[model samples]
Target: MPESATLPSATTKLEYLRKDLEDLRYYLDEFSAFLPLSVIIVNPQGFILDINQAFENLIGLEKAGVLGSTVAKLFCEQEQFAELEARVLKGEVIKGARATLLLRDRQISRSLYLSPRHDCEKNIIGYFLGIYDISENVKLTEGRNGTVCARTIELEEKSEDLLRSRAALMNILEDVAEEQKKVEQERDKTLAIIKNLADGILIFDPHNVLTLINPQAKEMMQLDESSVVGKMAAALTKVTNIMPLINFLGRNIKKVYRKQLELKSDKVLEISAFPFLTGRETLGKMVILHDITREKAIETMKTEFVSVAAHQLRTPLTTVKWSLHLLLHGNLGAITAEQRDLLMRTDEHNERLIGLVNYLLDVARIEQGRFVLRNKNVDFIKLAETVIAPFLEVSKNKQLNFKFIKPREKVLPVNVDEEKMVLVIENLVDNAVNYTPPHGNVTVSLSFDKAKSEVLFTVKDTGIGIPEDNKQRIFTKFYRAENAAMASTSGSGLGLFITKNIIEGHGGRIWFESIQSKGSTFSFTLPLK
Candidate 1:
């Protein structure tokens, strides 16, 4: 808690004696009567100094009867009342702590603001406590059906007496009251935004009571707004069939929780719950329900189309590849040099087409969530050697320097899908050789990093680097760099996209560094264990 500055001048200060604080307290009490919300003034030690007409009516207590009483004696929840009283007396201000109250044996929900009161001398004295009722739509239900409620707000008070101070308690109260009116206006705007949202919005308190449900949420969940606000979450779950969503909220209160729930054969909901935290108190939780049924359906249809198309294309492509292989190997018959040369070139293009089809099928499987890995421990050193070995021959024909820098520790075995790992590394090496100019360097290397928990595989190339403007879209499907597209080497751009997915599936990360017209280094890390 902190102290406020003392008032430097008050005309009544010199004229009044020590009892003037009592007179000031009386003036403050008079001011509280004008306030609509229930108000109280309490001493430094938690004893009530005064109560306004609204406070008496709201709490069902006579002002005179509870004047010297403590908050614990009046409120059913002693712990919360005591804690709030203690904080205010220590010079802290507590606001918007929308706490559920068990008053007169009936539950009531309200927002609270408690501020420490200081005299003209600035020494800590009493406190001002205010309550705003939000229980207009509140009700109760308990059984297999029940509702809970909660909102948490906390504040740290000005903890020290200030040297440069000059303000009175009256001025502070006026400021707070003015601020409250502005806050209410902003809250109205927020409500309007929530009401018009496409996604369903549901707010619940710690007591499991549904505090709010936007109109969109009500329509989607088939809820009757007239009866929904006060109902318990358990009963709401029965009506909405959102058991998985409710269960997630129950377990992970501290974090923002999200889960997809299939409520029916045709409907799926992406539910996200965010905890409203103020200081150390978790005031409440806000849940958003996004309808993802249509999106899911579209994704399924796309996957099916890709799968069917790839299957149909795969058969004819394989047949052509085999025929070209037989011709190039002379398995059919001997051929002229010019004829053989044309067949070889055709075979290469056919292979590239087949590779593209394979990549499409892999992407389809990935999108359908069917890309499962059958992992095995494999020596990446030998794997790299085998994949990069062929690139050397291609580099030689282009008159370029290509090399593989194997780590000194040698036998670097990693847990991965060997076939997929080969695709990832080979694609990188192929890109390196394809882009580098004649006589330029392309180096492939492997090393252990992050305390040997991961193995890093890198492909370095001194090539026509990616343009600054186009770098961000490089990993996107069907996107090729301008320079690469202009070059003779053809590329599908899915190579890096698929490579990234493969690395991530292995619990690794892929990243790169490049400067236009200079070089690029593509690296991915795979976990050892």
Candidate 2:
């Protein structure tokens, strides 16, 4: 190493190194041409040295438009780059930093990173500014125009919970409204039922205020059309402490109470007061007052009739039984075979008469609403087959084709009083078989719809059909069709009436569709579950 060799190459080497450094910086700036982030080079003297294609796009300006301009020229006057330049000169690196820069058309907000570079001698040159468009980010963070990741998830959960709560509340409201409507309807029905009785009804609120008084009550109290409502019961009918006592019974009595109240008309009114309860809420008191004057007379008349009929029936039955016994035992005389046969027929008729009396007694109990049913789950198809077996045998003798078609799906189970349902089916099948003509077909089919949970039992007969005009009256007690009456004058008309009551008790419906001179199809539907 010669001293001359180092000294002669110093100036030339400096020029070459400076040119190489400028070329390297130029290439570095060119490398940013395809970058998505904007690139800007700023000298320590606050001058913009160069910019890339991204910078041109971000500012919406041409490359030549921003050449040789100060960095401050690309920003608002308020956002000058004086402090940023000072920081770069101090050798600080700002990564992922942000700022708002202004252009001709709009203010461009961006995230920027600053990197300061120097030569081998350590003289500060310029800073490389990497900028990302942060308009969407800023809106999401501060401007409130976009959804953030965390906030979006939270809002979604809250919205779901809110929607579920709203649906539940709506269902509750609908259920409550439906229950209220049912209660109102039941109340109206009760009012109508009690008003039809030969009694006076008065309903009072908790405060002893008269809420409702039926027409009978008004008549008994000598009240005009608008006299009783909203007035105290004590004031209206001079029944002191009656309303309060009635309210007390409604709320705290916990039992039905009966008392006698003296009406203004000098009549002793037998009153039965009961509480009106809806769910767990107690509404008020209901008082029913029966005059009992005409009812007492009717009861006396019924008692006299029972005594007389019983005595008359007992004497005849005793005489017939003794006479039949003597004839059967051969105690009276050694009669001929023909005479014995006559005596046996008389005994049979007497026994049938006694059976009729027993049947009438049973019916009387049922008509008075005292009959209790032993409800059980029964296979309806089997039950129907059992009840129709006898009728089918009898129909065979009549040369009527009796067909029982089992349902494809085996048996349908129904909850009902087995004995009562058996009686009903037997009567209906017998009626059909009796009315059907010779060589006619009596078909019974069973079907079920699983979706509706209903079972349909149909009995179709090819016989003389009923008339359309008499259909409604067929179910009435002691009422028989004209054709039926003419055909079977010995039958009691109570069979169909009892059948209807039994079917209704089991929550089933029975109806018949018939065409005159064609046939009749008697169909009944029962609940599956």
Q: Write the per-residue lDDT of candidate 1 for residues 110-208, one digit (tens) a residue.
A: 777787776545666767766666553243223122233222111111112111111333554544444545766999999999999999998878766
Q: Which residue pairs collide, candidate 2?
A: none
Give per-residue lDDT, candidate 2, residue 323: 86
Alpha carbon deviation, residue 232, candidate 1 (Å): 11
TM-scores for every predicted model: 0.58, 0.42
Candidate 2's C-alpha runs over 4 A off are 1-217, 220-224, 227-355
Best by TM-score: 1
Using lDDT, give the best candidate's number.
Answer: 1
Q: Write the per-residue lDDT of candidate 2 for residues 445-503, one digit (tens) a residue.
A: 88887887888888899887888887889887667777777774356676777777777
Each model's lDDT:
0.76, 0.69
lDDT comparing candidate 2 with the true structure: 0.69
